[model samples]
Target: MRFLAHTECFFGKSRYDDLHSALGNTITGTGIALIDTAVVDSAAVRDLLSQVEIHFGNAIPVSAVSVLSEPTYDQLDDLAALVRQSDPSFILAIGGGSLLDLAKGVAVLLENPGLARDYRGMGLVKKELRTMICVPTTAGTGSEATWTASFIDDQTRIKLGINGPNVFPKYALLEPALLVGSPRKVALSAGLDSLVHAVEAVSSPLATPPATALAVKAVALITKHLPVALNSEEEDSWSGVQMGAYLAGLAMLNSPGGIASGVSYPVGTQFHVPHGFAGGIILPYVIDFNTTRGYRGYELLNPEMGSNRTFYQQIEELYGILNVPRNLSEWGATGEPAIRTLRELTLNQRSGSFNYNPIPFDEADLNSLLHLICQAD
Candidate 1:
């Protein structure tokens, strides 16, 4: 019954502009904006950021703006250094998950007085971080709603997550219009990622009733709307995808993810596959794997594709329609040796999700799943 996500969430086409008056004219100090370089460079996003600045007026000045590119753990340290010099009163994170995660790291470092590595796990930060507002330019990752921030440890090639209540953003603005310009590939990948989040959260053993409800609703929305949103110009489809992703994020924040995401992390990071694509590619296999152990979440999903088809079958078909990568080798995780390495890395970097899996799994189960996931189709 334990559920937590304290951020105030706003959803609409242009609701982001409301932040101007939401802060109540407190413009005495510096406001830092951590923006994705590619996103900020776009004409639309550039105009959006400018509007946000205009909304703030002079009460709080966005005195510093940093463009985040390919964020890594080292980047957090560098961002921290910059923040120390600027002394910003608040942080605005605008971009994908990496930028938002980096913003969390920067805010935590500003107040906690330590390196980003110090608070690598849950509940490590004793002090509250500076206020942060997250505006996600992409629909996946759910970084806007979650208390977890992930960073890569380049030395070990492991992506570590910083989890704590202090990491939660004070505000999350979900603007569907911002996602309209996403490349088709990005849209397909991110939409599937959101679907997987809903599935994993609903099926996790730790799921609370409220979280499960959100997960079910998210899954339904994603299943019905994602495919249409991928190639259509209709605003309703895109808006549905946006709201579904946010709900899926909230569900994961309360219940956490399970084996699918756990396996996807190492595979995606090690093989340079986009996280959403990696997760989507492995989703059907994980669903089949869980079915062996009496997992029933799929049964709870609406049986809309067809009465004869299983939920996994419907998703597998969707993967084909979306043209998701079919083989691990396509992403450079080829050969038995590479898969073995991925399996070991997955096991080594468990991310506390193994326990949340409804079925008991160990090295052998993981090995079998990896073989299936990597098999050429």
Candidate 2:
């Protein structure tokens, strides 16, 4: 029954502007704004940033503030350097998972000695981070609500991260309007990432009763609303999906994802595939594999995902509707070399995830899973 989410969140169409009070009251002196360069000019973000400038100007001089945009993957050192140079009092991160993750890395490293590479495992981050306010423009990753942040190791090109209490943001503001302009691929991929989280959270051995409840609801919301939200321009649909993703994130925080993520992280890093797409394509195989082992919670989830079909059936159909890549080969992550890299990384870098899976797996079993996901057609 252990469940924890400390972020104070606000959700609505234009609720991003509500951060004015939080900014004015909490952020004094110089602060840094980490924005997604892709959306810096959008009307919604413009309005949000304008609000920040307006409110924060009254409390502190705005000239000292710094803005960094479009943070990239495998560049944790670069991001941390920027943060060190800025030396801001706080950070306001607005954008997708990458931007928010960069802010988290910076916040943690600013207090702790050494680079992002110094902290890799759970609970290594002991010192309190600078105040961070997360606002997610995309309805994916749920980075705003989670205490973990991931980055690729520049040298080894391995995906690495840290998870602990120190990195959680103090505030999360969700504005569904900001999600309206996401490219179709981005929208579908990100949405499916949340769906994977829901399924994995409930299926994981680490799942508790409270986390399972949240995961079930998240699965229901995603199944019912994601497709509708994709085609319809209604804010309500987007809002439902956004909240669903957030709940799924919370579920995952309590019970980290298992096999699908174990396979996807290495596949994504080695193959240069988007993390969400990698997880999206691999999740159906995981569902099929887990269900065969009498994994719990499908009975509870099937009803919510559409009572007419099994939970796995619903997920497969959702994949078709969303037009996601059906196999790893489509993304060029197949064959012996890709398989070997995936196996090594999964067994080493992502080994922590193995215990959380409902069923036990050895290297041979993992190889079979990779082959299953890498199949053509």
Model 2: CA > 4 A from native: 13-24, 58-74
Q: Evaluate model 1: give its TM-score.
A: 0.91
**Which regions of candidate 1 fall more than 4 Å away from where they truly are?**
13-21, 25-28, 58-70, 303-308
- Candidate 1 local lDDT, 1-377, one digit each (tens): 68887887877644754566566655446687777766666766667667666766543333334433235778789879988898898888788777788888888888898788889889998887778888888888888988888888878867778888888888877767678868897787788788879999878988889998888888878877888888877878888888889989999888878887888888877887777888887778788888867777777675533445777777777777777776687877766887788877887787367787888878888888778777865
Q: Compared with the true structure, what per-residue lDDT tens digits does model 2 show for residues 130-193?
A: 8877878777788999988887666677766767898898888888878875777778878888
lDDT of 2 at 194: 91
Q: How far is candidate 1 from the true structure (C-alpha RMSD, Å)?
A: 2.5
Error of 2 at 216 (Å): 1.1
Least well predicted 10-residue stretch by lDDT in candidate 1: 61-70
TM-score of each: 0.91, 0.91
